[model samples]
Target chain A: MPGDAWSRWRAFAFFAVLLVAIAVLFAGASALYRVPPAAVVHDVHLRVEGPGWTIEYRADTTPNSTAYAILAEAADRLGFVLDARRYVAPLDSVLVESINGTRNGEDGLWWLYWVDGAYGDVGADRKALHDGSDVLWAFREYPPREASP
Target chain B: MNVRSFSLRPHKRGKVPPWKLALLLIAAGVLGRLVLWEMPNVEPVMAVALIAGMLLGGYYVILVPVAVMVGTDVLTYALGWSGAYSPVQILGLGAFVYSGFVLAAAIGQAYRPRLLFRTRTIAVMARISIPATILFDLWTAFGDWLAISRHPPMNWSLGQVLEMQVPFTLVHLASSLIFVPIFGTLFLYLHTHGWPMAGPSPSGTDDSGPE
Candidate 1:
């Protein structure tokens, strides 16, 4: 016996509609969450502040440059190791685990980044940068509200 | 018994004890989380909670999901497998996560009378899982924003937090859409047919809806 009022056709129709709705939602989210394409950057300043040490570099980067991309470029030029891992959604971006042999969680500090003195809201790879952009990667505990810069 | 024989022959009504059913559901839920730990937000706990409510009803609606979540939470924390949280953050986040699953169970409870071991019923349950998943994700995302994201290196506005949550919620919806119907049918089948290990029902009655 059929369980409820729904016929086989109705159930199929419902599932088809549900799947389409999900696909629409996925597309909308992808569009909304997408970072705008980055333009070629000239004279972008990058800084990495680790425990008792700081490294700074100024470089021109190709179009579509991101904070992480510039950091990787700087690391290659400066000969410092960049340790990171790519996580899928919800993160859907690379996480910097260590830098220059200093791993995150050392001394209760993790790697965080800021662009132009504003803390990065998205992943480093998603933090688009333009010419004259200032990028700072710092190893520190999360700042209290009053202490945030 | 063979798969065909086991599934085809419905067990005598009231043969499966409520405790056994509850225990099995809770175990399935916890194990699902443990096995799928690498896949964030893709676990059967939500489906199991919903089924528990529909099958066992009453207090089992609350007990089953809570046990699964608390059990997994404790195990993960003890093993240091999950994220680090402060005492306050733990309580705050726990409240949201726990309530989310309970709400799923509540939805199942509401549909208890209508739920049946049939294709149409399965479809309905699967459809309901979408909205249930959205609600749970939204609620917990807000909790995350409140407890963690609002502070720190990323001072995201509520809108930003919600926008970021979209992808995670989509993945969660996919997980639920797959699990709810499968688990719902399986549990409803078991409730109808009574498991082999099931002892006499404590209540000597079948409170779960008609087979």
Candidate 2:
């Protein structure tokens, strides 16, 4: 009975140690790898290229504003609808489904974004912008052999 | 403490038929996965797989989880759900994903003797779920890196992929911690009670009940 008790306690202790170690590792990695929040960016340029139409705007954005945030702001000012949906799996971020009534999968085209000439690797809500950032939302077919955003 | 104690043979005949129990588990696993499809890295399949190993034992351990994953995967692709992969990506990614569940089942099989329906056993199950989840996440993350993340457009380095994986892994850990014990207790109860009377054992009859 004593040996049994000892083994159980040992198991519990080992579990506790593992938990603590994981916590420490998570904290360390997060600190080391997490993208630091961007400072407030004045004159963040945003462009939306919809089917046969284009809209451009500039705005001073708060700190940590993502590409989606800027697009939503421009849409509000310009009076065009910015339709988006949040997807949680694969990653937690918003997908821009449509802009100004141009829905995704229409004519085999989807709304994709590029920031500073780089294709957005993450969802628009996760593609954080910095000072003088150039954000572009284009409704177009995916590039050859390219995965959908 | 003996080798025989860990042996998976001699599975007793419960009132419930092994096939029915297997179906119930597969359905639960598949449904849970579909319902939580949007919430990446959070699902009950792993927990159910582990429980399937413990309750059903033998080949059902592998059969149950495989059925759940393959069934849901087909549905996801057919329905055009998010994270639907191309045929090539499916083969590459599925190897890791399916194996993760199989590994969880293997863990459950190993821990079958300790599942005594006691408080200590519950704690033990909960504790083991952590590593099971971590292993699953790590393996699948590597798979993602190999099949998807390393490709063009993103072309993320392995370190970058791992860095991004931390949050998903944390959520997975949370999911496993919550589901493993709940399912473990539920199925253990069902096994003991032998619900849905009158069905054949998966293996040939062994009349001697669980040790």
Q: Judged by DockQ, which candidate is best?
A: 1
Off by over 4 Å in 1: A1-28, A35-38, A89-91, A143-147, B1-15, B152-155, B196-211
> Fnat for model 1?
0.20
Residue A58 in candidate 2 has what lDDT? Answer: 89
DockQ, candidate 2, comes to: 0.23
Query: Can you write out model 2's per-residue Cα lDDT over B1-211, one digit (the tens) per residue?
Result: 1112344452553546778778888888889899988776679998898777666677776788899999998898778664424467778889999998988877776655444445455566666777888888888889989988777666779888887778777767767766776776676656655553644334222233343
> What is the DockQ of the complex in model 1?
0.29
Error of 2 at B151 (Å): 1.5
lDDT (Cα, tens digit) per residue for candidate 2, span A16-133: 7556655654455345334437557776888888899999998875554788888898888889998887766334567777899898767767787888877776667767788888
> Clash totals for all models, in order?
1, 0
Q: How high is the TM-score of chain B in model 1?
A: 0.84
Q: Cα miss at B184, model 2 (Å)? A: 0.7
lDDT of 1 at B32: 92
Interface RMSD of each: 3.7, 6.0
